[model samples]
Target: MRFTWAQRLTIAAAIAVAPMSAAHAWNESGHRIVARIAWDELTRPQQVFASELLVRHPRFAEDFAARMPPDIAARAADDPERQRWVFMHAAIWPDLLKAEGKRLSERIAALPAGAEKTELERRLADVKRYDNATWHYDNKPILIDPYALPPAAPPGAKPIGVQQALPNALRELDDRNLPAERRAVALAWVLHLLGDSHQPLHAVSLFSARHLPQGDLGGNVFFVVKPRPADPTPVRLHAVWDDMLGTDPKLEAATKRQIVAAFPRSRLKQELAEPADPPAVEAMVNLWLDESYRAADTSVYDANLRAALLAPLPAGATSALPVALDRRYLPAALPVARRRAALAGYRLADCIRRAESRSRP
Candidate 1:
C-alpha cells in the first residue's frame, strides 16, 4: 500500500539490505571515499575528537587495529594520516562486524566443541549486537503497478530500518551524558549509514501486483546482466549500483586522492541537518532519504528496465535476457552515484560539525 508520510517513507521499504550479515549498500571502497570526503572538511579539533571516539569503540583492537595496515598503524595515535585511515575504517566498520559475525558462525559450526568455539561464540555475540542489516536502508516503496495493493506491513508490526536507527545514532553521539564508548559505537554507525541514506536503492524500492508483490528487496531481488565479454550470470541490480564509483577493495592514498579530486564537491548540495529533537532528527534524516527516492524515480529505473522488472519472466526466461541494461545505463547512472557519494560526504561533515562541534571528548 501507499505510505502516508509526506515523502511516503514507511518503517521499512524493502527487505533487509542483504540478510543483515552482509553489507551491500556500498562497496568498502565507496564508503571509504565518502568518509574521506568528510574527514577532509573537518577542522583539526573536530578531527581529534572524532578520532578519539573511534579509539574508544569497544572493538578498537579487534576491529580497527588488527585490520589496519602496519604502515598506518605505525603512525602516532593522533597522526593526521592515521586518523584519516581510521575514518575510512570507521565508515565501513558496521559492515565489518557483519562479515566477522558470519565468519565466526561458520567457524563455530565447523569446529567441534572446544575453547576455540567458545571464544568464537563470544566474539559472534558481540558482532551480533551490532550487525543490523536493516540499518543500511530505510527505503520508501514505489508502486510499479499503479493499481496494486499497497505494501501489507505498516502500523501493525513496523520493520526496523535506518529511518529510525539513524536518528538514534545521532542522538547517542550528541548525548554527552553517555559514556564515550557508547558514543563511539554511534560514531561508526553515523559514518556508515549517512552514505547509505544517499544510495537511490536504499531510499526507494519497487512494488507491483504480480512481479514484485513483496518489493524488489531494494533491488537485491531484481537481477540484471551487464554486457561482459564472457560468462555473465545475472547480478543483483543493487550490486551494480553499489560499485558505480569503483570496486577495488583497497583504500590506497593515491586512489583516495583521485576520487576526492574527481567528484570535486561542485554538484553536491544538501540541506545540512542540525537535528534539535527526536522528531526533528527524523525530519533531518528523511531529507536525505527523500532526495534519494527522487533520484530512483526519475532516473535509475528507466521505462524499459521497469517494464521487464514489473512483469514476471516469460515461461522459463531469465533477467539476463529481459532486463539487460543498454550500455548507456552505466555512463548515465555513474555520475548520479558519484554525485550522491560526494553529497553524502558533505552532509556527513555538516552533520558531525553541527552535532558535535561544541562537544569535547
Candidate 2:
C-alpha cells in the first residue's frame, strides 16, 4: 500500500517513542527570543501591551498541541485516507489574524476628524509594535517547501496563495475599526499565523480507520521521541516539534553552543536583523518551514527509525507491535522529535534575523 504523506506522518507517531509531556520543550526557546527583541524596541506601555497579548493568547508561544480534539486522531487511524486539499487551508493563526484585522479597520474608520491624526499615529504605533514584535512568531524561519501552494483553485482544494493570506489579513486590518491595542493583537496574530502556516503537518490530513482511527489532530496525537533515557513514554507528534527537539537541558545547552559557535554573535545579529515587512517575513517563514521538513524527513526521521529498529527489544517481546513495550524503538524515536524541534528553531532564528534586518530603516 502506497502510504500517503499523512500516513507516513501518523505512522511515525504511532510507534512508541518518547514521552509526550516533554516533547515540545524547544518551543520556549524561539518565543523567548521574539519576546526579548520586542521588549527592547517598544515603549514600557507598548511592552506591557505586547506582554498582555501574549498572555491572553499563550497558544501563540507554542503549538496548541494538547488542545487538539481526539476525534482528529481517531479519524486518521480508522480510515487511513489521504487528506483533502481543503484541510490544508493556512493554519488557524492566519484566519485569526484576518478576523483581528477586520476589527482594527473598524476602529480606524470610526475616528473623528479632530481625532484622526492622533488616532492614525496611535494606529501606526500599534502597527510598528506588531511589525517589531511579531517577527519571530509571524515571519521568522523561512519555509523552503518543494511543494509550494498553488495560486487559484476550488473551495476545498489546496490553495496556492496561502502566503498572500497574511498580507491580505494585514490590509484588512488597515481597513478595520479596532482599538490600537486590539490592532496590535491582530498584527501579533498575523506574525504567529505565518509560523503555523509553515508547519507541514498543519496542512495535512490522514486516513480515518484502516489502522489508527483518529486523524493527525494537527499531529498532536502522533507519538514521537522524548529525549530522556528512562522515560520511554510515547509523545504526540505536534508536541514533539512544539517543545522537545533540542530542549533537553543537556541537549538544548549543547545545541545552543553549537548554533552560537557556528553562527557567532555578528552572524546571529545580522540574521536577526533581516526585514520584518509583512510580505518579506511571510515569505521567509515559509522558506524556513520547507527546509526544516526536508531535513526532518531525511536526516532526523531516518536516524530515529534506525535507532528504534536497532535498540534491543526489552526482555519479552511477543508481537512486532509488542504488548510489553519495545526499548530500542522508544530510545531511537525520541531523538527524531528532538532533532526536528531543533531544526525548526534553527530555521526560526534564521528567518527572524532576516526579518529583523529588513525591519531596520
Error of 2 at 122 (Å): 29
- Per-residue CA lDDT of candidate 2, range 98-193, in tens? 344556677667776666757665654544433321222211121123232222324785333334554454443343354444443444444444
| True-structure lDDT of candidate 2 | 0.38
Alpha carbon lDDT of residue 27, candidate 2?
51
TM-score of each: 0.85, 0.39
What would the C-alpha RMSD of candidate 2 be, to one decimal place?
A: 16.5
Q: How well is each residue in 281-300 modelled by candidate 1, as lDDT tens digits?
A: 78878888998898888777
Q: How many backbone clashes does candidate 2 have?
A: 80
Off by over 4 Å in 2: 1-30, 37-179, 194-218, 225-228, 245-282, 303-361
For every candidate in turn, the CA RMSD to the true structure comes to 7.2, 16.5
Q: State which candidate has the highest TM-score.
A: 1
Q: What's the lDDT for candidate 1? A: 0.76
lDDT of each: 0.76, 0.38
